[model samples]
Target: MFRYLILIMILSITLAGCTEQVKVDMQGAGETIPTGSTGIAFDGKDLLVAKEGLIAFIDNIDTATAGSIYGYEGHFYFDRYPITITSKENKPYITGLAWQNTAGNTGFIWASDEANRRILKISPQGDVITRIPLTKIYPEDITFDGEYLWVVDSKRKKIFKLSTEDGSIVSEYLSPVPVPTALAWDGKNLIVGGLKNLNNPAPSPDNVQIIKLDPVSGNVMENVETSRYLTSPAGMVWINGKLWISDRNSGKIVIISDKGEPSTDIRSYKLPAVAPVLKKVEAKEDKNKTAQDVDEAKRAAEEARKAAEEAKKAAEAAKKAFELQQKK
Candidate 1:
């Protein structure tokens, strides 16, 4: 009987050992950041990352994060470190960023501030050139189509075309779906994707599908579904003819070929932990409520398990004592 029990224990341990570990392919070469990395852009050589309200640049496609943009040669990368240009005003919750070079001399960075419902144009030197007021409540994503800037009104289920020069809204188009989270332009068509506020009770589809649309008319051209590759697509950038998309919830960036085929996963570098600041009252309240509920449930489960074990041991001991008395 003891031998049989020991065999069962061994098998149980073996099965537990065989359980799959979180098999993250760490094959693609890049760095990993904390939780919320929403935007990624590549300028020929280096890569740019934007999270929260800060931007950072990296040199080697493999190197994830760089400290300062100065002294970096080849392709200039942008970092969140306040340069003379971005340091003067209050830092906005920057979600989307696009850069355009006019006349090959002056470069402008178009950034979207979701919290402020506005977009700002920053010069290569980091100076805020202009701020465009947006009627959309939450402008989560932004992209450029050579001549115009496209902004995603995530909460309003709409897309707005704004003049790159003054941030003036040229036109707005209602999205056929809900929650448009990301935007990309393939020279001819604009691609958008996010959760479909579908009626089904099951969670919205995990796939990241692109809605190809005419850049001029804002009319849907075709739907390209990306289920096998992307989980939840957020920010995207077209680099060297390939599309690089950031998966906001999955902590991954998927690279798609110009033909819209899944190519490789862009490597993300691990970023240094930033000090946690409880600035917003609502954020703090939500944190407290979540912590309290989790703690209470954990404590209750532990207590119940402990009581069950104690009762089982006591019962075993009592049975042994009674059996010995009977023998006596």
Candidate 2:
């Protein structure tokens, strides 16, 4: 009896070790482009992509309005162009998008509205459900980890933990990278795609690494280097136990395993004839450009330029302050 008990314990330990082991194979994977693919979400059938203000479908890219499989025959069954929400008197500048099944009953697409500093929850059919306001931080990428929403603020260099029910920030932490751009949640780790300072633009050949973090505390766990395959990895998603990342500058969708190994059967697909729908908002001014309007426009441009500089300085100051507090 004693020998049988010892054998069972040994077998259990071996099985547990095998289940937790990960193999990363990013090399040797076939590379493909999804045409300006930024943020990606899979709805078990088709992949949903986030553009400036429009959503595109990975399977049916040609469909102009119907970017999601939920779309009806032709018209976009989900949200349409000219997003109803506006910020700074302009349309919300959408950066990232994610699809979630609420309570396992309703479907919601959460968009990171950088311009407005908020996250918009809309129905697949383009109806506004509610807006979650996140002030001061420029939200770039977002992901859902079962019960909570994790958002990375690019300018602030912080990862915010938000309540899935109301969007209120539960906690925030300084990200390991200075310019964190994308986020993906594996069952066990929070993967962050980031770059060094945006001010120092690195050449394409420069190797970069994505950091994995402790999901609960947002502490750096490890950095996985993508020496050859990923160039400027931006938006990322975990699908079928593999991490799919979109390279902003390269315009390629890269697939890699948890261990950073490329998938063997990597494949690429041709984008449909219809080009991506670019957001074009006509100026609200009258047809004739009056001298006063022209002068006002010039003045406004100058103010914007100065304001941008000031904002950058303020962001840096805030970051330093936060870091000091963390040290304490």
Considering summed lDDT, which 10 consecutive residues are worst modelled in model 1? 263-272
lDDT of 1 by residue, 1-328 (tens): 9999999999989977652222223223123332355766554454556676666554433322223234221222223343322323555677777767678655677778776777878775667788887774577778887789988876777787778776766676776446788887777877777766534354334534576666555456665655444556677777766676777755656566545443132321112334646585667889999999999999999999999999999999999999999999
Name the top lDDT candidate.
2
The count of backbone overlaps in candidate 2 is 11
What residue runs in model 1 are displaced by over 4 Å at the alpha carbon?
Answer: 1-35, 62-91, 198-207, 227-229, 258-328
Per-residue lDDT over 65-129 for candidate 2, one digit per residue giving the tens place of the 0 to 100 score: 21234432221122223234345555766777777876665677788877777888878767878
| TM-score on alpha carbons, each prediction | 0.58, 0.58
lDDT of each: 0.64, 0.66
Worst 10 residues of 2 by lDDT: 263-272
C-alpha RMSD of each candidate structure in angstroms: 28.5, 28.6
